[model samples]
Target: MIDPAYVSAMARYNAWQNENLYGAAASLSDEARRQDRGAFFGSIHGTFCHLLWADRMWLSRFTGTPKPSVPGSESSRMIEAWEELAAERQVTDVLIGDWAAGLSPEWLAEDLTWVSGISRRELTKPKAQLVMHFFNHQTHHRGQAHAMLTAAGVKPGDTDLMLVDLRG
Candidate 1:
């Protein structure tokens, strides 16, 4: 059983982690951030792009926001410029905050059925399951990006859920 507070807290943590991730990225050279680190997405920028893509996909299902122009596209957008990507990521963080705040406990137990752009098939699952997967998916890939960033000498800030500001 997932509490609504837990969802909100996790959303805050996600936003906080992303802020730190992009902030650390700011310290790295353009070539370094783009270097291949063998991550599933290849580079920090690439993983970050895919992470945002996944976030947008889930957010669309969760809140009915506009989907991307390309569905299920995983190739990292050529955000060759770092500052733009970071700024947009911050906006995404705030959007995530509002999205999480709107969710109720009952909504999590309902089901979501949507056309799978990746598989091109109709898929259905409990909203709780999908939401859990959404956050978990972010954490998992972000961990990969974090490891790659650390290897490249960029240290993201604290990741503990306890450190996230509840009022954020």
Candidate 2:
């Protein structure tokens, strides 16, 4: 089980890593970003889109916010336009930080129950564990995006959590 400070730190870390990943992704042409690179999500743009969609989905379950319109099946194609996707991502990052900041120990200790869109099954689990998975899922996909960006000749810079300038 995790605590509020840990959640806040991870939230900040998520935003910092997102800034780096999106900055590098922004440098690439739309065609390059959308190009099939044999990743789990097909391309850099696709991976980013899927990550955003999943983030929103988890956030919705955790915070009672609105979920993404499309299901996980179409997550890779969530937002078609680069501008819209980027804008939504920036907004979601802030929302995530705010949500993490507001979390209470009592809330984290409770269990969350929701139906899985992908598996079509009702599931219940500890909120603390689910929150960890939320951040973990972002890292899992962002790593794919980072690799794609690098292969396309762009660097996302430092990814280590220790190097994430929390003062920002």
Candidate 3:
């Protein structure tokens, strides 16, 4: 089981990495960003869209915020435009940071019950473990994005967790 401090630190790392990725992505043209690079999500824009969609879904589960209208299968196309996607990403990152800041040890120790979107079944698990998965999912997709960016001749800076600035 994890604690609020751990949650907060991961949240900070998430936001920091997001900023780096988005900033580097901004340098690419629309066509370049949308080019199929043979990645799972197909392209940089598509991967980012799916990541944002997944973040919203997880946030909705954790905070009771409204979930994305599109399902996971269609996540890569969640947002059509890069500008819109980036804007929503910034907003979502802030929301995640705020939610992490409010997490308590008691909440972390509790269980979270929710219907699985992928399996379409009711499931319950420890909040701490779910939170860990949530952040891990972000890292997983972001790593793909980072590779895509690097292949496209962009540098997103250091991704090491120790490089993240915890101070907000």
For all candidates in order, the CA lDDT equals: 0.82, 0.92, 0.93
Over 1-168, each residue of candidate 2 has an lDDT whose tens digit, in order, gives 799888999999998888899999999999999999999999998999999999999999998999999878899999999999999999999999999889999999999999998779999999999999999999999889999999999988899988766643
lDDT of 3: 0.93
Q: Estimate, for each residue in 43-74, the C-alpha lDDT of model 1 and write its tens digit.
A: 99888887887887788888998765554554
Residue pairs of candidate 3 with colliding backbone atoms:
none
Q: Quote model 2's TM-score.
A: 0.97
For model 1, what is the alpha-carbon lDDT of residue 27? 89
RMSD of each: 1.7, 1.1, 1.0
**Per-model TM against the reference:** 0.91, 0.97, 0.97
At residue 39, give the lDDT of candidate 3: 88
Candidate 1 — which residues are off by over 4 angstroms? 165-168
Q: Which digits, one per residue and each the tens of the lDDT, describe model 3 over residues 25-71?
A: 99999899999999899999999999999889989989999999998
Candidate 3 Cα outliers beyond 4 Å, as residue runs: none
Best by lDDT: 3
- Displacement of residue 8 (Cα, Å) in model 2 is 0.7
Q: What does the lDDT come to for candidate 1?
A: 0.82
